[model samples]
Target: MAQMTAIKVRGKRSAKPQEKWTSGKKRRKNIAIGAPSFPTFAALVDSTALNRPDQRKRRRRHICLSTLEQLPTEILQDIFDYSANIELAFTSRTLWAQLRSQHVYMRLTTRILSRVLGYEDKERASSTDLAAATRLLGCKFMTWKLFRSWLEEQRPGVYRNTDQFLTAWSDLRPSMDLVPPIKLLRGPWTSERLSFLRIFSRAIENLLELSPPHYEVALSGFAEAVTEGSPNAVGMLLSMGLAPTTEMVRHAVIDSGCDKDIVIAILSHRNCEGHVGDVSTTNVDLLDPALWSWAEKVRRDGNEKGEWLTRLLRSKFAEIAAVPDAEL
Candidate 1:
């Protein structure tokens, strides 16, 4: 052990030489530490002191370790998805809005899906699975369009009319399932009263066209009033527009409970310009006595309820009385 130690000390004590170089006319000195036997090149290289604080300040100026908030929305989404908790995506409208509208998350998810299972395989699968998947993805419009096209292909021979087409397509309309209700209406329905009335009128017109005559008989008081107030209502019957066939008239008068006078008013008064004729049969009493009795009762009340009831009685009488005695 003593002999090994003496050899290591002799090796350490060996001499090292330093080379001198002249640059232009100036003589530059290369100082070696521990001279004669040993020297540190590391110490020679660091003659200019390291200004650590200044170095640190320089680094800080150029190397900005930016926070996540400083990044763009696309970059932020990519960063957030891997590290963020599940609750972060669902916590509020703001988060959901951020995720759903962003292309970054969509691309990330699509990439992951493509990697796990081949993307093209999904399209080659059965149509039912595709339909369900599309619905899950909230691409309902595309789903229904595809469905309708398939249906049309299957029924190649049949050409549906406008009414039939509307019925067939009704179910494919977009629903308000995802939308919040307050955003839909935006205000109280009270302000929409006139618009409601117009819609109600149009709905009634459609009902009259599509419904059986007996269905009209079952209408409530308010509906009866609306029909009575409409001047064009009875003309729909008398002009053969209602077909005026015995069955159609009976259906209108008996089943629909149409007012007799309104029916007469539509028939006896040409163009229904509201003129009373001099003909004896044109007299209200000379009309169907049963209907006249009902009309008198309706008129006696004279409110909206009365106007409606009287109008109904008058309409029914006119419809029934319009039939020839010979036919009866």
Candidate 2:
């Protein structure tokens, strides 16, 4: 090995010199031959940072994929509701539970509905007012289908078999009469005769995983159920007896557009799907393996049979459309 000699240069040509160390009574002196500026911990850190390879600007980590997740759950929920996303209950089980809170929806709806229906005071709703709101909306069973069981004095055996079913006050006539100004309302009116209370009540309540029962079959009222490709909503619709056919629905729940987990949930629902009702079918219905196999085929074969499996599940609305109300 050859011995290298230190060469000193002036100005920019000079290499940065190594920091010199001296014990006690340190004083400024002439620059050493090749000695560099004394480095402090901060200087070292800064140099280390400067030398590091450039990295892509780091993204902010959050509970959810976007920083929008950092906002208060209520505000996030408001965003979810105001935007095209409809409701979070259809998206995340955790977030839905935290944010879905039918209490809030029912609270706001009942308040607004009560005010609109001349039954509530906006500033301070009394217990009586709250009771009246609850009575009018009738969410006692938490779902309309369950309420129906109580109403008709019927066993839920038939409904429970399919797993879909809501509340009505005995004193209040069924909303079919569209009492008062409710009939004069907007184009989005449901198939049922909706009062202002019914409309607001249903709108608020539907911000849930499963919407109130009658609303599910209403023309165009089921928008939240089908919009933005919510797997929970899809599953709920199927559970509620919505036809699972591929034509009008594939656009809403396909893998290309929706979260994979949600699509999986929708495809895997067995009890809720119509395939189980078919006496002639020998194949197992909506099993994960079968559904995944079809999905894999779609991934491999390119949409050739992508939507074929969807035709197997039945939707409640489709079933209703297939049958006349008089017959129903």
The prediction achieving the highest TM-score against the true structure is 2
Per-residue C-alpha lDDT of model 2 across residues 75-148, encoded as one tens digit per residue: 77666544423234446555555555554554444333333332322334354444443443442223433234
Q: How close is candidate 2 to the true structure, as a TM-score?
A: 0.23
Off by over 4 Å in 1: 1-194, 200-205, 208-218, 221-286, 294-328
Q: After superposing candidate 2, which stretches have Cα over 4 Å from the reference?
A: 1-135, 138-223, 253-258, 271-328
Model 2: lowest-lDDT 10 consecutive positions? 176-185
Q: Write candidate 1's Cα lDDT for 1-328 as tens digits.
A: 4555444432323533232232222232323332243347776556434645554455444444335434566765775555433344455555555556434344433432222222231234344333333232332122223433433443343534433333332332221111111111111222232222221122122233433442334233223332444323333222221222233223334445555454444335432232333222343333455544544664685634346645554544455467543443
Q: Once model 1 is optimally superposed onto the true structure by TM-score, how far is the C-alpha of residue 207 displaced, in angstroms?
A: 2.7
- For candidate 2, give the lDDT: 0.40
Each model's RMSD to truth, in Å?
A: 27.6, 18.6
- TM-score against truth, every candidate: 0.18, 0.23
User: Candidate 1: how large is its RMSD?
Assistant: 27.6
